[model samples]
Target: MEKVREFIVIPQKKPETVRDLLGWHRKLLFDCLKQELKKRLIESSITELNRLIGKMVPSFEGEVLDSAAKLKLQSINELLQEAREELLVTKKVIKSFYKSNETIIAAIVKSHMGEETLTRLRDQHEDTHPNLLHEPGWMLEYQVAKEQWDKGKAAFLTFGTFMDPAKADVIVISNPLDEKIEFNLDWREIEESRE
Candidate 1:
């Protein structure tokens, strides 16, 4: 009864209820897992593309293109097929990622403005993103953001100038499609730099 006489105990504010803390932790875990998966997928895709590219015909300044060039055609065809398959898989991965991104954006929109506002935000995003239309891979990088469509359409939209314009070949906005994704002969300049 010594301290019970007139002692007033102030209850400490429960530090972020257990549920809130757990929710935050879970979100962090999800983000980490998603990023790791995405990294692995992108790496795999790049490896596949590189492998295909390695098997293709070497570039030259003025190589004679014989209509009857059958020596490397078979190997090139096989490599092309493999590349196509890998691109298809990559397209699926990209679509999944896009859906995830959209979901996250939608969540943010709903949190701040509600569902009705989300549609407007999405429209605004599409409008503002203004892709450079129908440019080849090489020029697309310098002038626009390009995305690979499932139907083998590579679409581009102008975003802005590159930080170091000379170093910027193209900023690939999306993964390649499943079909034989080929850049125009004019766009070969960008590809030559890698060689």
Candidate 2:
């Protein structure tokens, strides 16, 4: 994996509604995914091209290229084209999945963390500017809310920083309402399970 990169957004003020909070969460995750996806696609293409060149270099040792060499080159080009097409298809699939489930995900988040609590938390952090995620007061509030409501299987939004991107610690919004719904955004696990 490439050096883990971060894409963060700090709201100048607190979110007015649960919808707004969820929107921020979704935006952050999607932005990060796009960044990571671009990096991975490039890395994959480079790796494939390097492998092709490694094979071609040995075959070109004798100077005179034959029909077999030409066919091999054609096959290598086809493999590269296939890899590019697969990456594009993967991108489309991810976007489609995100769009299809966006509304349902928002509804689920709203239900897990009620509007009243969201409003209360927003009011509590009304004065904290820009650094809501890092503010001591907001952090304390988040922990308290998690302990209080999470015990009852409720949910709340939280922030994390300097975490491993590959380990799925990207966004740790605790949603304990439904046991079957794994809200943990582990991209690897999702892909593995899908496979």
Candidate 3:
């Protein structure tokens, strides 16, 4: 059994204002919710995989439990394949959740900073802004923004939900605000192309 871990990040000093308190509370709550969802999804995948593997074991040599065991072994492989596909699908769904939240955050920040300010910030950061590019969710936004800029489309900064290191999803820049975008990267393709 895997031990599930929960993380909480509270402000160094207690929140002084009502808005600060609310913002902190919301961040903590959403962090927990996101972790729980990820845990559940992972556990579900493991359980299904284990169940299928167990069913497969009975079909091996020795005193095979009849043709039923063989059928079950075949079924196990199919089930495992299905589980893999489902896991990929689930990952995409999770990514989409973060992307949608990013959109909302982008809108809020844009409203406050104004489009020109956002563009200036992006330009300042595009090549050399160390902090923005290295931050947790910012890289994704930066990549999306760069892609959109290359295509002459509007770019946006948004927040992304992530688990490792567990910090509030912060600003990320995305491009092509009107089009549905996916950040599926194929490392193998990139490597092959380079060669």
- Using TM-score as the measure, which candidate wins? 3
Residue range with the least summed lDDT across 10 consecutive positions in model 3: 161-170
Runs off by more than 4 Å, candidate 3: 1-39, 47-65, 115-195
Ranking by lDDT: 3, 2, 1
lDDT of every model, 2 decimals: 0.38, 0.46, 0.47
**Structure candidate 3, residue pairs in collision:** 156-174, 157-172, 158-172
TM-score of each: 0.33, 0.35, 0.39
Candidate 1: deviation at residue 129, Å?
Answer: 6.2
Q: 29-146, model 3: which lDDT tens digit per residue?
A: 3553464366467658768878877766765647746787668767767776676665555445544444444334434445555767545554544333122223455556556656
- Report each candidate's C-alpha RMSD, comma-separated, in the order given: 24.7, 13.9, 16.8
Local distance difference test, candidate 3? 0.47
Candidate 1 segments whose C-alpha is farther than 4 A from its true place: 1-72, 127-195
lDDT of 2 by residue, 1-195 (tens): 123222224333334444444445545445535644664775588587769868797968978778888888777777777666666655444444333233233344345666564455445544332222334554464566457544553333332211111111222345433334423244455456456
